[model samples]
Target chain A: MNTQTIPPLAPDAPVVLEMTNISKSFGAVTALVDVSIRLRQGEVLALVGDNGAGKSTLIKILSGFHQPDTGTIVSQGKEVRFASPRDARAHGIETVYQDLALIGDLSVFHNMFLGREYHKRVLGLNLLDNRKMREQAQLYLDTLGISIPSVNSTVDLLSGGQRQCIAVARSIYSSPKILVLDEPLAALGVRESAHVLGLIQNLRQQRQVSVILIVHNYNQIFEVCDRINFLHSGEIALDASTADTSEEELIRIVKSGLGRKAIDAAAAQVRPGPA
Target chain B: MPPTAIQPTKKNAVGVKVPRTMREQLLILLSRYREASIAVVAIVLVIYFQLGSDGGFLSPSFMSVVLRDTGRLGLIATAEVMLMITGEIDLSLSAIFSIAPYIMALLSVTYGVPLAVGAVIGVLIGILVGAINGIVTVRFKVPSLITTVGTLFFLQGIVVSIYNSQPIVAPVEQPFNAIFGQSLYQPTDALLSWHGVTAFTPFLWALLVVLVLALVLNRTTFGLHTIATGSNIIGAREIGVRTDRMKIYNFMIAGGCAAFAGIINTAQFTSADPQAGSPFLTLQAIAAAVIGGTSLLGGSGTVIGALIGAFVVASLNNGLVMIGAQATVSDIYLGAAIIAAMILSIQVDRLRTRRRV
Candidate 1:
C-alpha cells in the first residue's frame, strides 16, 4: 500500500549472490513465481512473510534443497547451479535450518564440527583431535559470550537459547560468504529470541558476513536487519530498507495482500447476498 | 548487548540449589553407569551357570569357549550397532555371514584357489551385498527393514539351492586354522597348555574389530557425520553432510564384518555350514546391541556397550546348554533376555532424559 523505498546499493558494496526470475511449482501448487532477490556483501537481509507466503520455498531453493523450475543463480557474478546441498556449500553458501540445526545426541564440540572433523595423523591413522576441537569450541562460545557448562556437554541437555547459539556458531565456523538461516528464532522464549537477535547483529557488524534470515517476528526484522523482503501469495510484495519501514507499515502491507477478499466479504454482507 | 552480557539480577533466580530426592539420585547413578549395570547382570548370570552346571562353567577352558562365541557374536553386533545408529537395519548380515564362508570353502576346495584369497573374495562379496542393500534403500527410497529382509531371503535362497542343504567341509591345515577360529596360543604339550592364557582366536579378532570400530565411531569425521545424519537427516543435509553416502559406507562395513564372523566360524570348525547363521543369529546380534544400550530408534550407540551385550547373550546361550536345558528352551531364554535388555535400556534412557530436563 505504501511506496517501497529500498535503499540504493553503495558503490563499493559488491553483490554476493543474485537469484533472477526464480519460479518453482510443486505439482499444481505454484510455490514461487518470478521472485528475484539479491544479497550484497555484509548486509543482513530479512525475509518476512505470513505462513504459506512462499518464504520457506525460496529459502529451500537458495539452500539447494529444491531446484527452481526456471531461474539463474549468480554467485559473486559467476553463474552457478547448486544440484545438491554440497554444491551450495562449495560456493560458500551455508544454511542453518530451524529446529534441527545441531545433532541433539552429540556434544557441542562434535556438533560444531560434524561434517568437518579435525583429525591428527597418528601411526597413519586419522584420529580425532578432540582436545583441539574442545578448546576451539570453548573459545568460539566464549568469544560469542555464550555460557554453557562445557563443550563436551550434549546439545540436547542444553537450554533452547544455548542450542541456537551453537547452531549459529557452527555456521560461522565455515567462514561462508553468504549465510542463510531459516527461522533461527522460531519457538524460542522471548529472552532466547533477544539473545539470538543480538548474535545476528554481532555477526553482521563484527564478522561482516552477508546473511539472508527468514523470521516471522517483525520486531526482530526491525532490530537486526538492514533490508526487508515481504512475500505475499508467491511474490515479493514489498522490498525496502528497515530505516524506510515500520512495524505498522509492514502489518498494513501484509493485511492489504488479503484485503481484496475481505472487501468482497464486506460487500457481500452489506448487499445481503444469498449464501 | 546479548542477554548473557546483561546478567539481569532477577531475585530468587540465581544459584538457588535444592537438594535432590533419593529417587533422583538413584536415577542419575543408574543412567550414568547403565553399561556397568548390564555388565553386573551378565556376571551374575555366569556365576549362576557356574554353580548350576555339571561342568564348571567358570573353569578356564569353559570360559574360553564362551568368550570365543561371544567374540564372534560381538563383532557382528558391533557392525549392527553402527547401522542401527544411522537409523537403518541390515537383516541380510546373518545371511551374508552364513553364505560367505560357503563361498570361501567352495573357492578354496573346488576351484583350488588359495584359501586366503578365497576368504578375501568371500568377504568382498559380502561387502558388495551390503552396498546393494544400502543403494536400494537410499536410492530407491525403500525402508531399510524391507530392503534388508528381501535381501536376506534372496541370499538365503541362493545358498540353500546351491548347497542343497548340505554342509561343506575343508581340511584343518596350518596358518588357516592358526589365524582364525582356533585359540591364539596353541598348546605344544598337553600338560602345560597356554590356549586360554593368552586369548581365544575368534575373540581376539572380535576384540580387534570392536576396538578399531569404536575408534572409528568416536574419533573420526565419518563417526561425526554418522551421528549427525542419524540424529537429524534434514539438519545434516542443510549442513552439506552427504548422509546417503555415509549410510552406504556403513552398510558395506556391516556386511564386511559379518563376512569376517562367518570366516572365523568356518575356520574354527573346518567346515562351512550353509545354514550356520540364520535369522535367529541376526536377532541375537540385534539383541546384543540393544542390551549393550544401543537404541533401536537410532543416533545413540557404542561399540563397548554392544560388546558387553554380546557377552550377556553368549553367557545365556552357553549357560542354558551347560545346565542341560532343552535346545528349544535356549531360544526361549534368548527371547526373554532380549525383552529384559530392552526394558533396562528404556529405563536408563528415560532417566538420562529426565536429568536433562
Candidate 2:
C-alpha cells in the first residue's frame, strides 16, 4: 500500500473540540467505552474501525442524535451539552448521515435550503422567496465548483456522486465548526470517492472547518486526512497521524487486537511534540 | 463527454442568446407528463361523446348536470389526492360525506337548531372524525390504509344506526337551501336551461375550493414540508419537520372537504339520503386521483390533475348514459376508459423519456 510521507503538525496547532473519555451502552451491549478523539481546526481527521466498532455510535453522540452515558464535550475550551440535533446545529455542529442526508423528491435548491428556508409575506401568507433562494443556491454550488444541469433539477435525477456532493455542500453551507461525515465513501466508486475527497480538501482550505470522517478506505485516509484514529472493541486502540502510519500497520491493528505496549508506542509517537 | 462541451441554451430570432427561465426549464424537465396526457385524453373524450351522442351530450342541460357531478367528485378527489400526497389514505372520508348533511338536518330540523349553526356543527363533526383517523394512525403506529378502513365501517355503522337507514328530507324554506341550492337565474330556453337547473353553484364552490387548495399546496411552506415528509419520513424528521402534524392537517382538510361536499349535495337536491356516501364514492375519488396522475405510492401529485380526473369520470358516466348504453355496459365502458387513460399516459411518458435519453 502506498503511504504519504510524514509531515509533523505544528506543535501549537489549536484543538477546536475534544471528546474526553466518552462511554455509552445499550442495555446489555456496550457500543463505546472510554473512547475519545480530538479534532483540530482546518484538518480532516479519519475515524477508522471495522464494522460494529462503535464508530457510528460515537458519531451519533457528537451529532446529538444519541446522548453519551459518560463524557464531557469541550468546544473551544468550554464544556457544552447538546439536547437534540437542532441544538447541536445551533452550536455549529452538522452531520451527514449515510442515508437521508438529502431528500430526492426536492429540487437541489430546495434541499440546499431545507429547514432554513427564506420566505416573504404575500397577502399575510409566508411564501417561499424563490428568486433569492435560487440565486443563493447557485452561489453556494458555484463556490464549491459543483456544476449541475440546473439548480431546479430534482435530486432524484442526479448521480450517486452528485447526490453525495449536494449533501456535503449543504453541510458546508451552514459554515459549521465541526462537520461529522458517516461513511461518506462507502457506497461510492473509486472515481466518485476521489471526487468527494477533493471536495473535502477544498472545504478545509476554503473555511475554518474541522472534519471527522468515518471511512473504511485507508488510501483515502492517507490521501486526504491529517490524522487517523483506529477504534477497536469499543475503544481507541490507535490514534496517530496518517503520515506517520502505513496501511499494513492499520490493517494489523484493526484485524487483530493490538497489544497494550504497541498501542502506547504508536500513540506516543504521534503525541503533541516534535518527532 | 466533457461538462463544458454541453450547452443547453438556444438562440432566439434577434440573434441574442436568451436564457431559459426556470419555469420553462421546469416544464421541459417535469417527469410526470401524466397530467398533460390525461388532459388531452379528456378533451378527446369530450369530442367523442359529442359526436357519438349526436349533439345530445353537449346539450346545455346535460353538460350542466355533468358539471355539478364533476364538482362533487372533484372536491372529494382533491381531498384524497392531498392526503395521498402526504403518504396516507382515508377510507372513512365517504362516511364523513354521508353523515355531515344528516347531522345538519337533524340539528336544524329535528332539534330546532339554527341552520348556520347546524352547518358548522356538521363540518365540525367531519374534522372530529379526521382527528380520530389521524390519531389512530400516528399515535398507534397503524398503517393508515387499515386504520381508515376500520373507521370507514365504524362511521358507516354509526350513521346507519342513528338515522335507521332512512332518508331525511331537507326543508325547502330553510336558509341552508337558499345559500347552497339557490339558482342564479331561471332557465327560459333549452340552450340556457343548463344554468337554470341549479345555477352552477356547486361547481363554482368546488372550483373555489380547488383553487385555494392548489395555492396552499404550491405556494406555501406547509406544502413543501408535506412533500418532504412523504418523500422520506426519516429525512424530514432529521430536519425538524413535524411530519405527524402535517399528516393530521391533511386528514382534517380531507374530512372538511367531504363535509362541504355533503352540504353541497343537500343544497342541490334538497334532501339528505342516508345511503348517499357509498364505498363507490371512495373508489371514484381514488380513480380520479390516479387517472389524473397523482401517484398512489405518494411523494408527488397535482390538484389540477385531480380536477381533470374528476371531469373525465363525470363525462364518462354522463356520456355513457347519453349514448343510451345499458347500465352494465356503461360500467364496463367507464372501467375501460380509466384503464385506457392510465395506459396512454404511461406510453407517452415512456416515449418522452426515451427521446430525452
Candidate 3:
C-alpha cells in the first residue's frame, strides 16, 4: 500500500545503463517476463514491487547470480553479459546484498577488502602488506564523513544500520560505476532506515555513480530516489518519474487484477505503512 | 523512565531473573575450571601416592620421570591443540608420529647415510605429509573427522607396510641413544653400574614445543585466523579471510609436528618397530590436547593449557601403570577425562556468553 507516490524524474538525469526486453525463467516457472528499466548516473532509481513481483529475479540477473534468457544489457552504451558476480565486479558493477554478506568476525577493514585485498611483496606479490591495507581502509571510510575508529573491531559489534552503511562503503570502495542494493532497509528501525536513505541521497551526489535500490518501502523510494519502476507478476506494470506519480496509482497498478473494478477498489483503499 | 531513555522496557517482555545460589555457583565455577582443576586432581594423586610410599612420589627421581614422560606427550598435545583451534581434527597425526622415525631409520640404515642428513630428510617428509593432509582436506571440503580418521588408518597401514620394506634398523650408538632415552644426570653410587634410567631429550623437546606453540597461538596473525575461522565461517568470510588456507595450513603444521614426534620416538629407541607408534594415536595426542585446555569443538583454547593437559594424561598413565592398572583401564579413564573436559568447556563458554548480556 502506497499513500504518497513519486513525481517524474528531471530530463538532466543521464541514463548510465539499460536492460531491454529482459525475460527470465526457471525451468517452467517463468519468474520474469519482458521487463526493462533504465538507470541514470548521479540519479537514484528505486525498483518498487510487492512480494513475488520478480524483483529478486531481475536483480539476480543483473548481479550475475542469474542470467536473463533474452535481453540486451547495455552499460555506458556497450552491451555486456556477466557469467558471475565476480565478472560483473570487473566491469565496475557491485551489489550490496541484504544479508550484508560481511565477515562477521573480521575487522571493518578486512570486511571491506574481502576478496579484493591489497598486498605488497618483494616484487608485487607474496607479503600481505597488512599495514597498508589498514591505512587505506581508514582512508576509504574517512572519505564518506565516517570513521570506523578501529580497523580491528569485528563487524558483529556494529548495529544493523552501521552494518548496512559498512556494506555500502565496501561496495563504493572499489569505485564501481553501477551499484545495486537489495532490500537494504527492510529489517531496520525507523531511525536506521532514515540514515540509510540519507546515505543513498549522498551517494546520488557522485556524478559517475548510478544506483538501483529494490525496496518495498515506497515512502523511502519517494524520499531518496528520482524515479521509480513497479514490477508485478514478473513484469514491469508501471515505470514513472517520482515527480509525476502518486502512491494511489502505484497501489492501483499493484492491486489491479485483470479488470477495472479491482483497480478502482485498490485505488480507494490505499493506506501506507506506519506513522 | 523517560520516553527517550535507551532501554524502553515493555512490562510484558520482562522475565523473572533468578540468581543462582552459592552452592550452585560454586558447582558452576568448578566445572568451568577445567585443566586447572584436573591438574589439581593430578597433584592430589601425586601427594597421596607420595605419602603412601616412603615418600618416593615426592622424590626428585619420580618427579623427573613424570616430567620426562609427560614431555613427549606434551609435544603431540600442542600440535593437536593448534589443529583443534582451526576447527579441523587430524586424527592421523598419531599415525604420522609413529611413521616418521621409520622414515628416518630407512634413510639412515638402508642407504648408509649420515644420521644428521637422514634426520633432516625425515623432518621434511613429515612437513610434506602435513601439507598433503592440508591439501586433501581443503580440496574435498570433507569433514576432517572422517578425512583424518581415514588418513589415520591409511598412515598406520603405511607405517606397518613399509616399516621393514627397506629392512633397516640403525645400530644403537652411545650418544645417539642416550639423547633420546637417558637422563643427563642420575643419583648413583661410585661404580658406573647399569640398572638405571634417566630423563631424555624427548622431554626437553616437549617443553620447547610448548613454549613456542604458546607464543605462536597468542601472538601471531595465523593464530588469530585460526580462531576467526573456527568461530563462524560466514563471519570469517565477510571480512575476507581465506579460512580454507588457514585450516589446511593448520593441518599441515599438526602433521609436520607429529612427524617430528615420530622421529624423536625412533631416535629414543634407536630402532624402528613397525607397530611401536600404534598406541600413541589417540591415547597420548588427544589426551594431551584435552588436558592442555584446547576445545575439540574449536574456536578457543590455550597452548600452555594443552601442555598441562598432556602432562596430566601422561602422569595418569604412569600412575595407573605403577599401581598395576591395565592398559585398558588407562584408556577408559583417559576417555572419561577428555569427555569431562569437553563438557566443562562448553558449559563455561555458554555461561560467559550469557553473562555478557
Candidate 4:
C-alpha cells in the first residue's frame, strides 16, 4: 500500500512489461497482495527484498509458474494470461532461476539447445542437428563476449561463473523480450560475481532486451541495475531510480518497513552512493 | 615434468591444431568417450580368456554360443542402459522378459493364435507393463526401483500361477523360429568351410538393436532429453523438458527390450519356463550395463558399451566353463570386474577434472 514512485530514467522508452495490482494466495496463505511493477525497454530493474517478502511470488507470476488471483499482466500494451511456463516462454519472457537450469552431463551446445533443439529430418526421423547447434552456440557466446574453452566441453566441467554465463546466454539466444534473472550471483564467488555483473552490464549496453533482476545484494543491484523495486511483506515499499537512491537508504527502508512518507524523508537525508 | 610431457601441438592440413602426442590423444579420446575404457577391458578379457582356454574360447562353435548368450543378455542390458540414462531402473524387466515368452507360447499353443501375432502381443504386454511402471513411478511419485520391483513380483506371481510353475513346450514352426533365434548360418566342415563362424539369428538381432539404439541415444532429441532428464530433472523441467514423460518412455523402451529378449529365448529353446524370471537375471543385466560403463547414478551411458559389456560377461562365463573352472568362479570375477570398472571410471573422471583445471 505504501508504493513510492520515482521519476522514470527513460521516460520515452516503451514499457516492455507491466504487472498491475497482482495478487496471489496459496490455500490459507496470502503470498502476494496488490503488487505491481513495470520494466522499461532495455532497462535492468532490480527486485530486492528480504526472505518471505513475496519476491518469489511476483517472479513466479511473471514466469507463468503461477497465475495471479487478481490483476493484469500487459506485455507491450496487450494483456496476457500465462497458463504455464511454456506460455510465458512463448511470449518471450525467459527466466533463469538460481540453479541456472543447465544439465551437467550435457555438452555446452547441448545445454544451450536443451529443450528447444535444432533438428534435421533424416528418413522421417527428426535427428539432432548437433553441428548447427555447436556453431550457433559458439557464435552466440562470442556475440555475448562469453569466453569458454569449447562448445563440446561437458557443462559439469565448467566453472560456476561459466555455467551461469551459459544459462544467461541460452536465454538471450532465445531472443526473449524480457529476461528475468533470480539470484544469479548468490552462489558465485566474488570474481565470478563480477563476471556475471559484467555480462548484465554488457547485455544492457548491447541488447534491446529488458531485464528484471531479483537479487539480495544491494551493491550488485546498484552496480548494474537502472532502477530498484523494494518489496516488503507482500507489497511494493519503494520504487526509485538507482541513481536517486543509495545502498544505505535501500537497506534502511527494507529493514524498517518504512511508509512512503518516511521513505521519502529518509531519501532526502542521504546522498545516492555507497553509504 | 618429463620432456615427453611437453609435446608440441601439430597442425593438420585443415589448419586446425591437433594433439601432438599419442598420450595426449589417448587422454582426449578417453575424456570424450567414457565407454572407451570398458571397451578396452572387454578386448583384454577376450584375449586373456582365449589364451587361458587354449584357443577353445575362440572356437567357432563356442564363440557362437557365447555370442548367443551375449545377444539375450545384451538386449536386457540395453534396456537397463536406456532407463538408467533417464535416472530410472526397471527391476521388473526380467519379469517382463519371463512372462512375455510365456504369453506368446500360451497364446500360440493353447489358444491357437498365429505365432507372429502372439509374439507381437507378447511384446505389447511388455510395453503395457512398462507403462504401468512408468505411470506409477511418475504420477504416484514412487521411486522406479520400488515400482518396478513391485511389478516384478506381481508379474512373477502371475506367471507362476498361470503356468502352475511349469514349463510350456511350444513347437514353433520354421522361418518364424529362424527369424527370431535359430542359427542363420552354422559353419560346418562340408559347407562354408573357410569361414569357420556360426551366425545365430539372436546375435544378429542384438547387433541391429544395439546399432539402432546407439543412434537413437546419440543422434535424436529424445535421447538428449532423456540424458538431460536423468542428469538434472529439476533443471530439465525448468527448461521445459517433459521430464516425467521422458522417464515413462524410457521405462517403456526397457520393457520392450526385455520382452523381445524373452521372446528370443523362447524361440531358441522352444519352451517357456515360469520360473525363468529371476532377480539374479535382473542383477546380471544391470551388472553388464555397469561393466559396459553405464553410470548407476545415471545421466551418462551408451547402448554399444552395454552390448560390449554383455559380450564381456558372456565370454567370462563361457571362457571359465571352457577352462573347466567352477561356475561360481565366474561370479567372483564378475563382482571384481564391476568394482574395478567403477574405480577406473572414477579415476578417469578425476583425471578429466584435473586436466580441465
Q: What are the RMSD figures for all models against the true structure?
A: 5.7, 5.0, 7.4, 5.6
How well is each residue in B1-357 modelled by candidate 1, as lDDT tens digits?
Answer: 133444344321212122278876666666666577678888888778978985478766677778888988998999999999899999998899988988988887888887788789989998999899999999999999999999999999998888698988866466778677764333342324443434476887888999998888888888888877788887877777899998999999999999999988898888888898899888899999988878888887888888889998888887888888875686787788788878877876776675662
Q: Which stretches of candidate 3 lie over 4 Å from their true place?
A: A1-40, A45-96, A100-180, A206-212, A227-241, A244-275, B1-71, B163-168, B171-221, B290-293, B320-329
Task: Give lDDT: candidate 1, residue B304.
Answer: 81
lDDT of 1 by residue, A208-267 (tens): 778999987777777777788877778876677777667776666666666435433432
Scored by lDDT, model 4 comes in at 0.83
- Tell me the tens digit of each residue's lDDT in model 2 across A69-175: 99989888888897777877887888988784687678889889888889999989889887788999989888777666678767766666677778888887888
True contacts kept of each: 0.58, 0.41, 0.15, 0.59
Docking band of candidate 4: acceptable
Ranking by lDDT: 4, 1, 2, 3
Interface RMSD of each: 5.2, 7.4, 8.9, 7.8
A best-first ranking of the candidates according to their TM-score comes to 1, 4, 2, 3
Task: State the weakest 10-residue window (summed lDDT) of model 1 chain A.
Answer: A266-275
Q: Chain A TM-score of each model, in the order shown? A: 0.86, 0.88, 0.83, 0.86
Clashes of each: 0, 0, 19, 0
Evaluation by lDDT, superior candidate among 2 and 4 = 4
Best prediction by lDDT: 4
Error of 3 at A243 (Å): 4.0
| Chain B TM-score of candidate number 2 | 0.86
Candidate 4: fraction of native contacts reproduced: 0.59
Mark the regions of model 4 whose C-alpha exceeds 4 Å error after superposition: A1-14, A20-31, A66-72, A77-79, A186-207, A257-275, B1-29, B183-199, B354-357
